[model samples]
Target chain A: MDEFIRIEHLNQRFDLSEPWLARMIYRRPKKFLDAVDDVSFGIERGKTYALVGESGSGKSTIARMAVGLLTPTGGRVLIDGQDLHDGSLSVAEQRRIRQRLQMVFQSPYASLNPRWRVGSILAEPLRVFRLVDGPQAEQARVHELLEQVGLSASDARRFPHEFSGGQRQRISIARALASKPDFIVCDEPTSALDVSVQAQVLNLLKQLQRDLGLTYLFITHDLAVVRVMAHRIGVLKSGKLVEEQATEKLIESPQSDYTRMLIRSAPRIHRAAS
Target chain B: MNGEKSAWQRFLASDFFYDFKRSPVTIVSFVIVVTLILMAILADLVAPTNPFDPGSLNLMNGFTPPMEPNAFTGETFLLGTDDQGRDLLSAIIYGLRVSLFVGLTAVILAMFIGVSLGLLAGYRGGWVDAVIMRIADIQVTFPSILIAVLIFGVARGLLPPDLRDELAITVLIVAIGLSEWVPFARTVRGTTMVEKEKEYVQAARLIGLGSSQIMVRHILPNVLSPVLVIATITLALAIIAEATLSFLGVGAPPTEPSLGTLIRIGQDFLFSGEWWILLFPAVTLLALALSVNLLGDWLRDTLNPRLK
Candidate 1:
């Protein structure tokens, strides 16, 4: 299998200690929180790998590290065989690495700049990356992006607040695609939307993945979402990966008791006799 | 999507304009501010005489009360004449120009300094945040007027004796500008701290946008509403501080006196019964400052998230 993305023994420890002066005055020891511990996972090209866990189980932490938002305290994150945290790389090389990766945050409202109209937001990556020449071409590309996300070209003139939750998520997805990224880390992208809206966003994500042949590291607490979105599932329990397998096999028979508990705890829709 | 509407129509339909229309006090305050500003700008055309031009003054007309002929020269003065025979109306109009110039310029200077420092402190937390915030804290403990006075004195003392009067207005502006910055820095730093944590900032970081770009492009606009509220209030404070400094004899020089200077000159003749000298300029200053304060108050309430 082509390892398009790889995380080897990733760890992220956050210092929860008081300020130096406060600690000195109080004579208290430094404290730390292990946000992620010895977690490892990989994704092949064009496949989605879902990391399912409860809140504070290091799902988002791992997602952040995967996207290079947080440098791992230990171990490595290699994308397309290039080490993301290697400081020896030139600034241009680092930028090239970043351009290949994009992220869609959990809260759609919080992820997009509210002050910017939809056109500029969608056009930003193309402009920054210098992918398209001139304003007219960039505008055309932005219109295409809007249409790709199932929005009209005219919607580009509107602000983020004008859109409903699902439409905003769609716009965000469009923004992530603007960079023409090969890999995207979606941190519970649909979790904040309504249940009906969630399905629409999920379908959009899946459709985008199929069309673009893009890889996704889908992080969420909902196993039901994982069942639909992921080809492979990694069950994370308190900063540790307890179980990893094909999503169908895992759903059919969860090996770890924690995974079994998560599966059992997830809500299910009961179909009436038909 | 309402994309077809012109920018003017969009602005009129916006929540800000809607709120402005709903508040009668803000409307009145805004009208007063606009009228005062217009009068100040058109002082040359509007004023009956040139207050600053010594050539235009007639010493014989001195102390003529409102619409009253001077007992000595039989010259009529609309709002009376000062000790120098400069028409009170023209002097106040010209003084309005000076006051508004100093106030607006000082506020802009303060906003620039405070916003830049605040962004630096808040975006780059740890020692930078601590030091900037500590300085702001220290300044906030003292009345801003005292700080402005101290700054004005130091600045004035630093200048050469020959250039002192020439640059006094600039020094005064610097003083008031510097004094008003603490509140802006404090307000912006707090807002920036909250804004930098928002996911858009994080996303900007992830996308290889540098710290400065992220702060200016992504975070700045989000944090600006609160800064704007602080700014409108600070405009009033800055104007009052300028007036206070000028009233203390350190601000605008005698050649081009601000409203504060006019009030200071007016106060002396108050006991001798030339009340128009004091009363006219004093009322002009009062109207200008009070209107700005009311507008600022309206802005604070309008922009307040708690009220929403």
Candidate 2:
């Protein structure tokens, strides 16, 4: 299968102790920690792949490494069937890759700088990547994005703090959209919002995904959100991937004990039967 | 994506400039500091007499009392004349000019050293950070003036006695600037340490930004607000340190009378009951320092997010 995003035997290890202290205390030359222990996964074009795990399961690490945020200790990540990152690339190549992939951070409000007005924040990627023609033309698109995200164009004048939590996440989503990226790594985009807002944001993500033909590597500990957004789910445990299957199969018939426990523990809300 | 229109408009409309106007003290001090800087920048056109011009001196006009008429010159001196027969008003303009020059040069030099070292230490974080921080700590133990003095003495000592006088001001500026740089470096290092962990920095790294670009573009802008506050306050401190050094006869030459040097020159006649000689320059220094320090305080309050 032609994967949109592919991770191959990726491993990340951090030096837990300083080199000097480790050497001096017991001649333990290097004190290392395996943050992501040989994790691998793939997401096909226009697909959503979710990594569901408890905290410290190395889910975030794997997600971060896949995007080339953290350098892997070993292995490779191929975005669009090209190893854009093995260690490092030329500046021009990196910029090209960044244009294709964007991120939505967990604390939606904190992710966008508070000092910046919403309109400018949204337009930043457009100007940085030179995606648009001029200021006047870019301003037109800014209004369009604000409208698309259910925000009035007048609201663009205000800062991030001025908006509600749900509105802020929408603004963040609009910002990610501004880059015209095909793949987005959403690191718990709705974790900081209320339950109502979470569903609203999740639904918006689904709509945008279908509309824009976007692929997502959605990272979250919340299994319910994973169920709603993910096409496939990979369960992680202690820096390792324990199971991988279709979202329906994983939810209905979880083989791994950790996955079963996670499914049991996830909060469910009552909905009218279709 | 259209950074220009957004940033400019926000800056114009923001409470930043309005906050400066809210306090009367800050307004007055800002005025004073701006006036002093203007005077220093435009010294020649406004000064009553050229203090540096040797042939213009009238020995008979020397020691004329403040606001009193000079007997031999028959000129009503506003602030009187110093023993060198230079008009006290003109001498002050000259003095203020020298003090400002030294202070500004030193601050710029210090900022250069501190900021570069700080960016390096913070971004590279190993033996470099340790060495820089330890050096800053060791320097901070002694008062900065002493460090300036020690550096000046060593630098001047290495030069021949004949070249020392000509090189004194440059040497003094270097000494004061190098000594004061530790605070800038320390503050920048602390800020760099915090900023390096931020996700945007990680994002930049992911996008394959070089370490230099990460430090310069991503981290520098975030760290600059604090550095600005520190720079403003340090400007006042740097000016004061320059004055103090000059007053001790180790600063500028006698031909170039900074406020501190003028005060030291006037001290001789203080006991002779020629009090105006000492009083006016002393008050000028007080006013200059107070105004600058006040402005620095206001800048610190205004720039800080916690206060806003």
Candidate 3:
């Protein structure tokens, strides 16, 4: 199947217990929230696999684990046959692996640092990975990245606040591409934008994927977005993956009640009688 | 060149500069503080006489009132002479120099220590955070002046008696710096805690950057605005702390008296009708402290987005 990304029974349990003193006084046991259950999925090379779930369904948790930002409490995340959470890997190996993947967060405003110019923001991955040698090369690469995201090269001199929400998402996508990563985890990248802007950003992502032959684990709560973006879809409910199938088949006939309900609840545009 | 010019023009047209121009009290305080600082920095060139020089003192000129000829020397003193016959104007100028030096060095020292510790505590946030914050909590319970006094006393006790006077100013700086770092640490820690959770920091982490790299490169810049505001406010506190210590007879030595020392010397003759000694130095101290504090207040309100 040439799976480019694999999640093997991933689980994440967050400690929600009170402090030790409070627990002792109240005679309470330690409490925990299983944010991500033993869920598993895989995406083939150059394909998009979308995880659709409402808030608190642990979609973001799975996304973070996939990008190695958060280590799962149980099981493993393998990228290109390498265990991302494996402690035995050397520091250089870990970094080499990290350079192959990147993330696009939900909130465009919160994702890019406000204090930094767009040039520095895009150049960070390039600099970190030592992709370019000197300042001139770095600047050239930054300009190239800015242009690749449909922004002017001069826009690199501006700050993130100067851009619209969709443009900021483009910058975020540009940053993700800076490392020349083959795999990207996009966690609700367009959910915060307006409908028109969302379509633009989604089209940009699809265009980037087509051009770069990239693999993506696209996370979102929007079935409409998934229909346009994903080849395969996984419906997540309360930290568990309830259904997984080809996107068209699932949209046509969602097996799980939760998936059916989610599809039904999604807002639709009504047409006036001609 | 064009970019630099536009950036300057942008800054001049920013809401910050507009706010600064709008407030009369802030403008007045800003002017006062700048003038005082300039006077202190240029004291050597600005003062009428070398007040600290023993050879420059004339005992016959003692108790000379403002703009009045001395009874014996027949030489008019501008702000008058002290009990030691030193020029009050010159003494205040030199005292301003010492006061400003001590205040500035102490605040820099405190900010460095506090920001570093705060960054560590907030970023690491486990046993490291607990220990650093607990120490900050304990230090904050006591008035900072008392803590400074205690640190000064302990430091003085540890030094050799012969070097006590020689190292007194340095020791005083360290004392005030140690005592004043609690506010900076608490403030930086609070800001760092909030900043480290931001998605940029998470992105930095995901990009194979180490924890320290994320804290320093990514998180530090974001957390610096509050730190700057705290530093400005802490500078005022540090200056006042230095003055209080000097006033208590343990700060700047007699050889090089600060404003607080001048006030201490001035207060002795206050009841004996020589009130100018006490009043002049006290007024200078009040002006310096009040202006700096007002500027700090203005800065806190301006830089804080929540206030806006």
- DockQ numbers for every candidate? 0.81, 0.27, 0.80
Q: What is the lDDT of residue B136 in candidate 1?
A: 90
Which parts of model 3 are misplaced by more than 4 Å? A269-274, B1-8
Tens-digit lDDT string for candidate 1 (A1-274):
8989999999999999999999999999999998899988899999999999888999998998898988899989999999999999999999898899999999988988999999999888898888899989999999999999899999989999999989999998999999999999999999999999999899989999999999999999877788889999999988999999998888887899998778777757111100
Candidate 1 residue pairs in clash (backbone atoms < 3 Å)? none
User: Which wins on TM-score, candidate 1 or candidate 2?
Assistant: 1
On DockQ, the stronger of 2 and 3 is: 3
lDDT of 1 at A58: 94
Measured over all alpha carbons after superposition, the RMSD of each candidate to the real structure, in angstroms, is: 2.0, 4.4, 2.1
Q: Poorest 10 consecutive residues of model 3 chain B by lDDT?
A: B1-10
Task: Write the residue-wise lDDT of candidate 3 on B1-308 in tens digits.
Answer: 24656777988988999999999998998898899899999999999999989998999889999999999999998999998899999999999989999999999999999999999999999889999999999998999989888988898889999999999989989998998898888888888998888888888887888888887888888888887887777877887888888899979998999999999999899999999999998898888888888888888899888888
For model 1 the TM-score comes to 0.96
Candidate 1 lDDT, B49-116, residue by residue in tens: 99889998888888888998888888787899999899999999999999999999899999999998
In model 2, the runs with Cα more than 4 Å from the true position are A19-30, A87-98, A114-163, A269-274, B1-47, B150-172, B298-308
- Per-candidate TM equals 0.96, 0.85, 0.97
Q: Which candidate is the best by DockQ?
A: 1
Candidate order, DockQ descending? 1, 3, 2
Error of 1 at A225 (Å): 0.9
